[model samples]
Target: MIDSTISSFPLIGLVLLLGLAIGSFLNVVIHRIPRGESVVRPGSRCPACGHRVRPGDNIPVIGYLRLRGRCRDCGAAISRRYPLVEMLTGIIFVAIAIKSGLTIDAALEAIFASAMIALIFTDAREQLLPDVITCPLLLFTLLAAAWRGGWGEPVAYPFDLSLVFATESETGFPAMRAAIVGGLLIAAAVPSFWLIDRLDIFLFNKYHDWQTETDSTRQLTAEEETAIASYEHQDRRMKRLAMAIAIVSSLLWVTLALRLGNHDPLAWKGAWSGLTGAVTGALVGALPLWWLRTGYYLVRGVEGLGLGDVKLMAGIGAFLGWQGALCILLISSIAGSLVGLWMMRTSTARLATAIPFGCFLGSAALAMLLKQIIWLAA
Candidate 1:
């Protein structure tokens, strides 16, 4: 193991502090973004009373503890989630640093982990994954992959971007090329899936109408009847438009890459090969959910997987590569299934209740990343 040259506890402490600060900002994001409010323009305010949080009272976990977990002005009880998010981020940051040892990979992991935390809570609370976060995350991860070369092979100790640029052999083609490939693949894949979703919905509607006509045993409520009668896929045109854009973008990229040719013998020719793996991983991560969603709809005549989940998995593939995405699916499925079954038995949640699946995916992916770090340390 490379000596990080700092005492572990102190370093962890410092990072924990940073994480708490970042987590405080994340609390605002989770609250505001889903509601389509600006996360920046409006400072933290009491939800109950609309009193802007005083700076002294806004100190992450400490503020909550000092105030006895209530608003300083209004004295309304605050949710425990504020402190929990801060503490969870702190712990995740510490774990990543311990596993990665002050490396760039650790820093990148910390950022991604923070975003994942925000996504988890936002989805859990609202069942919405804001594109504001997920879209940027996807783009950033592709760049990170380019900068770090491929997954599994992070730049070594004495981390330097100059060296990253100087040593082309390490990164495969340049960072620019890898970014192009990763971006292109993501673009093409996401829209294709969107089109598939539109088609699936159309078919589901047709199937439902057929069943309604033929089967007398199934009784439809007034609300259900109205919903089916009014149901038209609202975003069909949007999906078609997106698919066209993606197709053009993908073809342009392939043409550009092919034109670039083999200029440098020392350049790692495997950049394309690496991207192929990423594309495969992304597809592997997304397709299973699509199959499950479509299959569930056929059986139950209700939408199971939201489009948010499909997009989230695609982003996961771009960031973690495909294998990590598969691991996320496995872990999340087990966790969600267990929780879902428990909810069915113990709560008002029925089999048809739409659980926030994106929450599970985000949480599971972050967990697997942490586990990866722990396994590396072990």
Candidate 2:
């Protein structure tokens, strides 16, 4: 037992180190993604002087300590967030390793937690949640759910459709039904994307046009041009990707249904269950918020929630399933209210102050994730 315990230490240490490196990359993501800068093109550089960060000075927390939190070339002070993010990631990774013990679930949890950390910081700093992060995250979580066979339990599909649509086979498997449901859900993405695009055009295009008209005589800065180009490119890529996934998923389902019929439905049961859970979770997570946002806009004549928040919730739902997503919403709402009250008491903040609700949501999601890990460990 002693030897086994000691041997595991190396793996734990490695996980921690890898997490710190990921955190460094996340810092880059949090900073550049919202600004429409490519995370890959330019290497890490001193924002103050644009000097490339030297290899020796980029060693996570150690590098910060060695350089005394100042750029080597420009001597400009670095934000404390860099090292803090790294340390926090390292610690969280270690805790996950300890609790979940170097499993695939542990890896997925680490990835989810890292993304949450990035979202937390990015939203807090920029009041923006880039689709670059949330969209891919949503896709990944759906895929991961399928890979995991489901969110560890039977999904309580909204409207109790599972009972109506998810009929069991002779072998007690709902493989065909699950495949059909999941396929339909995936195919729905294509139309969903179209609807979202139309909504954006209806809601935001006028404001964009107004800005363009107002600034018609003014020259755009180089950075502004780059950001615009980046955003447009990303938007196109995401649309294409979503369409491709929807088509491919639908085709795959058809193939499976035709080939299997009822003979061998048991083989793919887990995958179908996972897809169903993920799809249902995404809907459960985003729909309530979307309804609230629409209602608030109609009544209050102001946008209550950014679309990014809705997308973020969808991703979270895909990862955690409907139950976890709803829990996150409830926890985040309570936490946001408490923070708002505290801010009002301490400063000049009012009830209407624009709070970064995404930060709270991300934090709540992380807390929920940790709680799950701890529960499993216990």
Candidate 3:
């Protein structure tokens, strides 16, 4: 058990400061990622003016306050979103720190909070869950799991030596092995995504018959028709190439995972458990959406969800485990359905209107995490 009460105000202040800084960075990610812009380069700039923002002007909430919510160079009104994101991040970080304390779990939770904030804002604004964020997050959680499980040295009570790829007592490289295995798993995502995409394309072709409207009123030139045919042929070849890459990557990952799993299964400790949990969580989280996507296409001949949603779920599952992942799915679906229904009733949206499902997932996952923390504390 831990106390949420801050015995020292300075510690609380430091945690809040850290949170604000992370939130500031997240704002950059939200703004740049969807635009396919580099978050690191070009630095922060006033949206209304081309002038680069000064370091003093980029100081999170304080910067906004000092600037009076207006750009110094152009005097253009800055969006309230910037300060809001910074505050939200700081609050979430402070909450997690209070709940989890300054341990590995606290660090992990903070990372999770940052990811959720980024995903929520990005999805809400652009309906995208960028791979740049989700892919790295998945890798971080997998490695964190191994570290927390005592991969190299015994640290905590929940230590499980069985999770290591090799016997910790014998090999003395348990943490290293876990790290390598985790890395391999992370690398596997690229191929897995390619395979999933290829399968989707195949299913689409098999289930749907397609013919472009002949502009039935206008006859196409011979060259134009030939160009269209050539494009279709090239597209088919590209899909085939993608499928081949997926296959090779799948085989490579499987070989690595199997080689790692050759150690005693019964001795599986916290590290191994974390790896299995992540893999299982990813499948559990992704399969439902995949099924839904396929079914929707089969019946409606339209994609009801984006592939980005699937990757987002897999990333969430990697951090939260299968049970938590399932919980997030259920909650997000319910929330999305309710909101969708309301939108339709209010004439704000149509059945075919795309909803940002990733936003719902991010929000729901954060809420669930808070609930879990509260429940455990009680």
* RMSD of each candidate relative to the true structure: 8.3, 4.3, 8.1
Q: Can you write out model 3's per-residue Cα lDDT over 60-170, one digit (the tens) per residue?
A: 899999999999998999989899999999988877877767766777878988998999998888666765676556555555654454343222322222343455565
For each candidate, give its TM-score against the true structure. 0.73, 0.84, 0.74
Model 2 lDDT vs. the true structure?
0.74
Candidate 3 clashing pairs?
151-175, 160-269, 162-267, 162-268, 162-269, 163-268, 163-269, 163-272
Off by over 4 Å in 3: 1-6, 151-186, 205-268, 372-378
lDDT of each: 0.67, 0.74, 0.70
- Find the candidate with the highest lDDT and give its number: 2
Q: After superposition, how far is residue 216 of candidate 3 from its true place, in Å?
A: 19
Model 1 score (lDDT) = 0.67
Estimate, for each residue in 1-378, the C-alpha lDDT of model 2 and write its tens digit: 011232367787898899899999999988887676778869999999999998999999999999999999989999999999999889888877776666676678788889899999998887777666777677667666765663333334443234455666534556556666667776675466457547756864532221133357898888777776876687667667876876786777657755664565554565566676777788888888878776886788656676778888988887888898989999988988898888888887456626788998898888776775556568
Ranking by lDDT: 2, 3, 1
* Sliding window of 10 residues with minimal summed lDDT for model 3: 206-215
Among all windows of 10 consecutive residues in model 1, the one with the lowest summed lDDT is: 155-164
Better of 1 and 3 by lDDT: 3
